[model samples]
Target: MWDNIGSPFDYIAEKYDEDFSNSLAGTLQRNRVWHFLKEEIKAQKPLHVLEINCGTGVDAIWMTEHNCEVWATDVSANMITIAKSKLRDNSAVNCHFSICSFNQLEKRFEGRKFDLIFSNFAGLNCVDENEIRKLNTAFFKLLNENGRLTMVLLGKNCLTERFYFALKNEFKNANRRYSVALAKLTKDVLQPTWYYHSLKLTKLFSSFVLIRKRPIGLFIPPSYLNLWLNKHPVITKLATWLEYTIGSLPIFADNGDHIYLSMSKKITAK
Candidate 1:
């Protein structure tokens, strides 16, 4: 179902960590994700997790380290290969990796259920609202009662991106999120991407009740700015501080480069 988007991800599989996962901006944004992940995990022991678009399994490793049983999937075979290789040394970790696309979840894991369903870093943005609704229905059935779904999504308007691009006199790049566009994964690889407003995204997942949501890079900027931010350590430090200061404010919480949104399955009487 996602062959066009999934295959292009293969082009970046090898350098994904170097280009984004390990970049300074990526680290800060991910740290904020971890904060919410920990909060969800602390209440559920012997947790069972299903991660879609796992992307080399960094978060899968963290889940296993916390003693959670994890089944991580990505659409790209190259990505799953790297993820599986990374776990070879930790034979005891209860983590599994496989190549599966978002639309294939119900068919791929028919009888399986999970305590937590996770997708990070705008992976959910690969599809449109119709696909999202299909996913919402699948999630309702795949989740255990009270199970949680957490996603990190690119927001429609990013303050940092606007200022960053505007200063460069690049209005098109600054407003790219406002329209549908193909994001460049590599010089030759481009993938369709969609940006969402927090409320718009919440409405798409109608089956789940909102748990909490917050801005991820209100002050930290987007990962693409990592190179410049890394060169200015003091400015980066200040940005991180400012993020923690106001990232959670209701007024600014939904307007960042990315938004962390969590929701819970509603248990209805049979």
Candidate 2:
């Protein structure tokens, strides 16, 4: 069912960073993710990390620079190619790249276990709940005792998305994330994407304990508003401040354009 996942993402590999990863809005949201990442890495330095759907190896590079060993995987070969190219100059970096998807993690890693498993952006949104159930199983098997899983996924309800689309009178677009929809990867490629709420994920990963949940882009606008945000630096700064101040509140944490969540594997009784 997900055979075309790689093909769609491959089309965006070359310019994905330029378009989203480095954009003003993207930087703001990603910085929040990085903040939480630092907390995770600080707790356990020299971590063994498995990163799934590691587009362009941005996060992997960051982790390796901080003394972590990273095994980064992406389904798109082109994306992996770009990721590998970025690390070619840094031979000392302890990072590896591979072509793999979330569902295929079990077979690929087999007996391997990691101290942390990370997925960024909405990469995990491509699969449905059934696939997520499989991922939960794979995560449980692949992680060491007390290991953490960190993910940043698009949420089912986004205040910014709702307001942005409503101003344009795009009623359907405002609520598009509420159901399964095809997200435009590029002009010609649309891939199936699912928006998951924090509550839903808590139940899905029932075997694990939810340790952290933060709202990304709760006040910062989505990437689509990059042009407008660029023009208004002051508003952008204010939004950033607001997000930093109140994004962690329970009322707002699960309703952003994206959610950053971390869960720890439960130590089961024999």
Candidate 3:
């Protein structure tokens, strides 16, 4: 979906943060995702981070503030420009953003070794399983001993959500995007493939220690918050309260839009 769209994220880059920095759903989703991620960062030594498809630099800024050295990259030049602008006024002097995709990693960062590797929002889905599987070999050489890799991946539920969203919005142009995504999900076949399964994701990366999996979302909702924010203030308030109240409850965490995975590199031949 990413390569086909060539950074549709660029279409919303400037206002991405503004879209949901304070909404109940946004706050709850990010809070859960980052909170779980921070635990791993805190457990390990101060490390360098390599974030693939770093969207608009929001996460990059957060990482820098938490004292991690950040090298953020995306395939979109426009997204990189936005990231560079966000870094302009920040104190994460250790941060840098660039335009590089997974296929181009060797050409751009030939000898770089990172203490951690990160990507957010199902960026790994942008590539195929075979290619993504190949990264273990590439990253193994690039990671310091016992480094960690963490990311927030979009879940299969997003497809159904998108379907209902398009149906609710009733937009004529909605199906165009939906069809494209569905096609990608099927890979031109009859079946669909989502990027991660909490258990299977842990298994796929089992060459490394399976640190933990925390499902995000499971309760709140997706980006449609703009549809309900002002019309029903009291209802919104109640919803917001419910979100925060249940954000950390294991039963409710993964119901949102994304999930967090924190895995550490292992030293052994398994």
Clashes (candidate 1): 0
Instruction: Tell me the tens digit of each residue's lDDT in model 2 across 1-270.
Output: 123344688888888899999999999998888987888987546899999999999899999887789999999988988889888566336999999977788999999999999999999899989989989999999999979999999999999889999999999999999899998887789999998999999888877899989888999988989999999999998999998888867577677989889999988899
Q: Which numbered prediction scores highest in lDDT against the true structure?
A: 2
- Per-residue lDDT of model 3, residues 183-216, tens digit only: 2222233213244455656566655676666557
Q: What is the Cα-based lDDT of residue 254 in candidate 3?
A: 40
Q: List clashing residue pairs in candidate 3.
A: 215-254, 217-255, 217-256, 218-254, 218-255, 218-256, 219-255
Q: For candidate 1, lDDT tens digit of each residue in 1-270? A: 223334889888988888888999988999888977888887646889999999989999988887688999999988887788888566336998999999899899889889999999989988898999999999989999979999999999899999999999999998999887899998888989988998987899999898898899999989888889989999999988888888867577667988898999876779
TM-score of each: 0.94, 0.95, 0.75
By lDDT, is 1 or 3 better? 1
* Distance from true location, Cα of 200 in model 2, Å: 0.5
lDDT for each candidate structure: 0.87, 0.89, 0.65
lDDT rank, highest first?
2, 1, 3
Error of 2 at 159 (Å): 0.3
lDDT comparing candidate 2 with the true structure: 0.89
